[model samples]
Target: MRRIAFLLLLAVGASALALSPQEGWDLVAAVESGNQEAYARLVEAYQAGDPEAGAALGVLYLNGVAYPRDLERARRYFEWAQAKGSGWGSWGLAILYANGIGVAQDDQKGFRYARESMERGYPGGKALYAMFLIGGGAGLKQDINEGVKLIQEAAATGDPVALNVAARYLASSDLPGLSRDPKKAREYWERAAARGYFLARGFLAYDFFFGIGGPPDQKRALELARPLVGFEPAATAVWATALYFGQGGLVQNRPEACRLAKDQAKLQAGVATIYGLCILEGVAPGERALGLAYLALAAAWKHPPAQSLLSDWQKRLTPEEVNRAKELLKNLP
Candidate 1:
């Protein structure tokens, strides 16, 4: 959704003739300052005939940013703009259809609109179309080579999302035609992070923590991960791990770290293992039994470290204690 909004902003900037030069500047300021009333007034003033204004207003309605959430109204505005040959409107409608926001979910129709938008030179649509081609979804044929080329082209436009995607492809060692180029991946991630892509920030934080493509910099890892704790689950786990070990600037706080690990365990298997370890080590008071139980749970999930630890633990426990742990595992959520 953030990517969609970014693309819409780009489209609006490109079509600035929708309003007078002064009004366009005011609209940009209003958007930057999040002045909803000013934005609404400008959108109302130009929406009748300006395709750009119609597309922007549609996005505002779709997201309900200071306006009531009205999918039907958004669809109407998108359709109006698309009829006026607005590529952004085509992309917007494609998104709605793809996600079933206001219309029935129809991947085929969504792909058609996306293709149309891309053909009309919408960079966002090109990126989406590339993804569709790569994933072979929406009845599109899989063409990894072509998809890579398209994404590279889109990245050349300095689209942050495209840069992120390109970085992932370039960094993946498992992809058949791509080589793992950590240096290039770091460059792409840095560029995207500078453009405010939080996802890229999380990737860079992981790299910094693990010293991938560079020397370990725990301080930089903490700096990048701190603000993303609540917003990015993977970063939260990284931050918690760093806090637990005091590797970064954070002071050691095993209890808080254990709590954070436990909270994130369901979303990340590694975090589950970390939580189990915290419990097994008695890092927090009164958690030994539950920690063993969590270790059992992680072993059940096929985490190798947890499996090894549980195996050793079982050797030290009596049959009755083993039965109790099994019972606890059965009752675990």
Candidate 2:
């Protein structure tokens, strides 16, 4: 959902200082010291079209250095730099749009901007934009195949998240289109886990415990899960499920499982609010809560459970009600 890194560079010739490489470093020091006059001078240099000055101005605006926070201005400066064909500008603008920081959220805009940066050889932007494409289904149709390819492109450029996802697909036979290859999957997942993608580690635990992709190794599974339990509620739930079932490498630990499940359930309940709201909107076709049909199709696209529930409800609804739902879903994203 966001870009991963920042670069620090400044202009020397435009600053009207002794033109040396260290001049850029000196301007950066001035910014860090909250010297407004020096900061303004640097900004003026940027206005004169020095790429270094532009980059420095972008940093100042982005960090609120020696000035009030102004993400809108930062976004503008980034746009200027990007127009000059700098990767940083494109990367910065993509993040701003993706997270709705300096502009309205526009997933497609963010996706295209990020892709542009990546195409310009920005590795971090490549991974981040690909993530937006995968999660937001922006620009591209919601094709899991294309999403996987974008993710692979990011992984090729060394994005840990891409690696984590690829590893998960290899390990799990659950991914939509990838062939099931246990050994290859194990290799990818294990490599990602070593690099600290804790989710991949947790998935590795599942694989070892279930022996779907490899020989059962409960102890190794627990070893992997231990580091991941606190990272995500879902991960915690998996660990608890393992303990509850006493099937994974862990010895039966029901008390621990019960405690963890209770905690995890609370988090899940909060997420269920989305589903509940969709039902309230009458998008679930047979939503018992709201009789009005506003957007049944949205509910179906959001989840398989909603689709199944809507199908069941449609069987009992009158023809008029069913037709209304069909219309609503057709208009939904």
Candidate 3:
């Protein structure tokens, strides 16, 4: 009876380990595509000690993507993967520690883990560690040149996050040892956009609209900006500005522009300034009080243009009206 029971336990163990790596990959793909049944199977495989599945499960729990957010569970799965010596597991732990997700925030621990993962040749870890080096946070020495080199190397691997960060660094003039190069920025942005990064599309739209980095392509700008409207307020603000000025092959429509500007103002201080200006100038007509309120709201947020406008207008209002505007500003969310 003892031998029979031992044989039965062995059979159960073999059955639990039956999933092949290829099958695991397929399940991972299915989970990414939002198949709940596949996610369940993958979870089972993770429980059986499949390191890749464990790491993937950790990410899902961390991000709260398909699974409910459970940072503790995420940490456990990451620990399992780390026990298996997975580089990605180290990277996962680094992120959690850095962000204070599942445990007390420890930047030094995070940086150490990130460096270890990078040394182990994890792509995400390389980018993350390079970022920390660039910013010089968490006791790491600042080295912009070295950081840029690492970023460029990671970007060359076509990782979407790396592509975006590298593009931004290339476009920014403020970074030491890096000059703003619109053409180069556009190249990286284009690559990231092709890989379906939506923010890249927004950046490209802004660039095309403003003639930044390349000759302005108003038509292209409008084409890119139109589809992103409603969902991307910053992009919407750009499109609305273009529409107000009749640039980018769009017909001038002050009413529509004002409407769009007002819609975006709640989310962006710059848009609030635009909306206030439209009201103050009567571009929206018969809305001076509304304009003052909008300016007050923007000014409260420390927007420079709104503050400048408010300073100039303060002299025009009676003390009572100014107090009323101040009250409105205080109440703004």
lDDT of each: 0.70, 0.56, 0.71
Q: In model 2, what lDDT does residue 264 have?
A: 36
Ranking by TM-score: 1, 3, 2
Q: Largest lDDT belongs to which candidate?
A: 3
**Per-model TM against the reference:** 0.55, 0.42, 0.50
Which 10 residues in a row give candidate 1 its minimum summed lDDT? 20-29
Candidates, ranked, lDDT:
3, 1, 2
lDDT string, candidate 2, 285-329, tens digits: 334333223214324323233444555566667787667656654
Model 2 Cα displacement at 197 (Å)? 2.1
Off by over 4 Å in 1: 1-125, 137-140, 263-273, 279-333
The candidate maximizing TM-score is 1
- What is the C-alpha lDDT profile of model 1 across 189-259, one tens digit per residue? 77766544455677777667767667778788777777667445556767877877787778888888888
Looking at model 3, residue 255 earns an lDDT score of 76
Q: Kindly list the per-residue Cα lDDT of model 3 for residues 1-333, writing each as its tens digit.
A: 999999999779747754533344355446756788987777676676667677667766754435666779989988888777766678778888986766999999899888987787666578778889999989888998898778878777775446666776777556754467878888877765544344566677767766767887878877766656644554676677776778766888877888888767776555677787787778886435556777878787665567888878777767776676666655543
Q: Total clashing residue pairs per candidate?
A: 0, 4, 0
> Model 1 Cα displacement at 265 (Å)?
3.8
Better of 1 and 3 by lDDT: 3
